[model samples]
Target: MDAVLTNFANGDILAITWRPLLAGLAQTMLLSLLVIPLGAIAGLLIAALFVVSAGLARVLLMVWIDFFRAFPPLVLLIYLYFGAPLLGYEISAYAAIAVSFTLNTSSYFAEIFRAGIEGVPRGQWHAARATGMSWLQSFFVIVLPQGTRAVLPDLLSNIITITQLTALASVVSVPELLHTAQLAQATSYNVTPIIAAAVIYLALLWPLVRLMSHLDARRYSTKLSAAATQRRRRQETADE
Candidate 1:
C-alpha cells in the first residue's frame, strides 16, 4: 500500500499514460454532460407521474423505477454494446457508454426527484391552488422552486457517483481513465501508475463532494434563517 501510494505521488508514473488518461477524462466528462440532464428530465417526469396520477399509473411508474434501479449498469452496458450490433445498429464504445450511463442515471435521478418532490410541504400545493394556479402552474411556480433547492445537493452528489461509475466503462473497452491505466499496467507491469490513476479519481471527486456539502450547508442555513425571521415577524404582527 505504501509503495502504491509512494509511486502514485512520484509523478514519474503519469508520463507514460498521459495521453490515454486525458482522452479517458474527456470521454468521461462528455458522457456526464450528455447523461445528467437526460436523466434529470426523465426522473422529473417519473416523479411527476408518481405524484400527480393515481392507481395504475402510480403502480406502473413505481415498477418501472424499481426495475431500472435494480438493473446493474454493467449489464446494461453489455446489452447496449453487444446487443445493439445484432439489431443492425452498431454503436461505438463511447456511444454505448453514454446510453448506459444515461439510463442508469435516469433511474437514480428519478428516485432523488421523487424524494425531493415528496419532501415539499403539502400546504404549499394547497396555498398555490388557493391563489388560482393550476396544478402545472403551481408545480412550476411553487413546488419546483422549493423542490429543486432541496434536491440540488442530492443531484450534485449523484454527479459524483456518475464520475466514479464511469470507471465501469473499462469493462466495455472504453478507454476511460481506469482502462488506460490498465493498459499501461499491462505493458509496464508497474502497479505504481495505476495508483496514480486512482489518485486522479480521488483528486477529481473529493473537491466536488466537498463543494456540494458546502453548498448544501450554506443553503440550509439561509433557509433556516429566513424561516426564523418570518416567524418572528408574524409573532410581532400578531402582538401588535
Candidate 2:
C-alpha cells in the first residue's frame, strides 16, 4: 500500500501509461453525452405510455419496466457485446457498450420521470384541462417543468451510475477507466495508477452531484414561494 502511495505521489504516472486512462475517460464522456439525451426522451415516452395506457398495455409496460430495472447493466453489456454477435447482428465493442448503457439509463430515467410526473397533484392536471389546455400541453408546459425539478437529483445520481457503468466496457475491450488502471497496474506492477483512477472518477462525479443539488434546492425554494403567494391570495379573497 505504501509503495502504491509513493508511486502516485511521485507523479510516476506518465503519458505512455496514461494512454489507456485517457481513452477510458473519453469513452466515459462519450457514453454519458450520448445516453443522457436519449434517456430523457425514452423516459418521457415511457412515462406517457404508463400514464395513457389502460389494461394490458399498462401491464406490459410495467413488466418491461420491471425487467429492465431488475437487469444489471454489466450483464446486459456482456450479453449485447458478446452474445448478440452469435445471434447474427455483429456490433463492435464500443457500439455494444453505448447501446446497453443507453437502454439501461433510459429504463431508470423513465421511472424517475414517472415518479416526478406522479408527484404533481391531480388537481393541477385538472386545472390545466379546465383552462382548455390539452393534456400534452399541460404535460409539456406545466407538469414537465415541475417534474424536471423533481427528478433532477435522481437523474444526476444516475449519471454517476452510468459513469461507473462505462467501466464494464473494459470487459469487452472498450478500454474504459478501470481497464486502463488495470493495464497501468500490470505494466508498473504498482497499484498507484489504479488508486489515481478511483480519485479521478470521484473528481469527475463530484461536481455533477453538487450542481444537481444546487439546482434542486433553487427549484424547490421557488415552488415554495409560489405556493405561499397563492395561499396568501386565497386568504385575502376569502376575507373580502
Candidate 3:
C-alpha cells in the first residue's frame, strides 16, 4: 500500500513536476487549437471539392483521402520531422506535428463532412436553386448549414478524437503533456507524474465525452419525433 502511494501518488513528485506538466498542457491546448481548425477547414474544402467534382478529379481526391487515412500518423510525423532533414528540407517539431495532424485529421474530417453534406435533402438544393441562388450560394447558405447541423454530434465527436490525438505530438519531443510527463517520470524515477498526466487528460476530455453523448441523444430524439410526425401526417391524409 505504502509502495503504491510512494510510486504513483507521491505528493513530492507532483510538486516537482507540476510546472512542466502545466507548460505541457498549454502546449497541448495550443497544438489542438491549431490543428483542429486547420483540419476542419482543409477538410471542408476537400469535401466541397468532392461535391463539385467527378470522374478523374474525384478519383484523385479519393486517393488522397484514402492514402492519408490509411497511413499511420506517428510514422507520418516521424517521417516529416526526421526524414525531411535527410532530404535537405528542415522542419521544426511543431511544424511536423501540424502537417502530420492536418493530413490525418483532415482525412477524417473530410469523410464526416462528406457524410453530412450527402445527408442534406436534395429537395433543399432544388428549392434554393429555384429561388435564383447560384450553386455555391445555395450550398453555402442552405445545404451546408442543415448538413452541418445534422451532423453536429459527429463533428463534436471527431473534435474530441482530434484533441486526444494531440498527445501523439509528444512522440517528436514537442514537450506536450505526455512528453513532459515522461520526462518528469525519468527524472523523478517515479510513476506519479505519468499518473498525474492521465488525470489531467481525463479532466480535459471527460466533459467533451459527456457533451457528445448529450448531443447524440438529442439528435436521436429529434429524428424519432420527425418520424412520428411523418407517420401521423400520412395517417391523416389516408383518413381525408
Candidate 4:
C-alpha cells in the first residue's frame, strides 16, 4: 500500500508536476476551442452546400465526406506535420493539428448536420417557401432550428468526441495534457502525473456527458408526450 501510494499518489510529485500539467491542460483547451468551432463551421457550410448541390457537385461533396470519414485522424495529422515539409511546405505542429482535425471532424459534423437537416419534414420547406421566403432564408430561419433541435443530443455527443480527440494532438509533440503528463511522469519517476491527467480529463468531460444524457432524456420524454397527445386526440375524435 505504501509503495502504491508513493508511486501513484505522491503529493510531492503532484506539487512538482502541476504547473506543466496546467500548461498542457490550457493547450488542450485552446486546441479544442480552435478545432471544434472550425470543424463545426466548416461542416455547416459543407452540409448547406450538400443540400443545395446537384449532380457533380453533390457527388464531389459525398466523396469529400466519405474520404475524410474513412481516413484516420492520427495518420492525417502525422502526414500533415511530416509530409508537408517533404512537399516543400513548412507547417507548424499547431497548424498541422488544426488543419487535420478540421478536415477530419468537419466531415463528421457535416454528416450529422446533413442528417438533421434532412430529417426535417419536406412540407416545412414548402410552407416556408409559400410564405415568400427564399430557400436559404427558410433553411436558416425555420427548418434549420427544428432540425438542429431534433439532433441536439447527437451534436453535443459529437462535440464531446471532438474534445477527447484533442489528446491525439500530443502525437505530434504539441504538448497537450497527456504529453505533459508523460513528461512529468518521466521526470518524477512516478505515475501520479498520469493519474492526475486522467482525473482532469474526467472532470472536464463528465459535464458534457451529463449534458448529453440530459438532452437525450428530455427528447425522449418529449416524444412520449407527443405520442400520448396524438393517441388522446384520436380517441376523442372517435368519440365525436
Q: CA lDDT, every prediction? A: 0.83, 0.80, 0.93, 0.94
lDDT per residue, candidate 3, 136-209, as tens digits?
A: 99999999998899888889998998888999888788889999999999999999999999999999999999
RMSD to native, candidate 1: 3.2
Which residue runs does candidate 1 get wrong by more than 4 Å? 1-11, 215-231, 238-240
Predicted structure 1: lDDT: 0.83
Candidate 2, residues 162-230, lDDT tens digits: the string is 777777777887666888788888888777778778878989988988998887787679889999999
| Cα-based TM-score, every candidate | 0.83, 0.84, 0.93, 0.93
Q: lDDT at 125 for candidate 2? A: 92
Which window of 10 residues has the lowest lDDT sum in candidate 2?
9-18
Report the poorest 10 consecutive residues by lDDT, candidate 1: 4-13
Which segments of candidate 2 are over 4 A away from where they belong? 1-4, 7-10, 212-240
- Candidates arranged by lDDT, highest first: 4, 3, 1, 2
C-alpha displacement of 89 in model 4, angstroms? Answer: 0.8
> Every model's Cα RMSD, please?
3.2, 3.2, 2.5, 2.3
Tens digit per residue, CA lDDT, model 1, 143-232: 988988888889899888888888888888877788888888787667765776787788888999998999889877987899999999
Identify the runs in model 4 with alpha carbons over 4 angstroms from their true place.
231-240
Best by lDDT: 4
Q: How close is candidate 4 to the true structure, as a TM-score?
A: 0.93
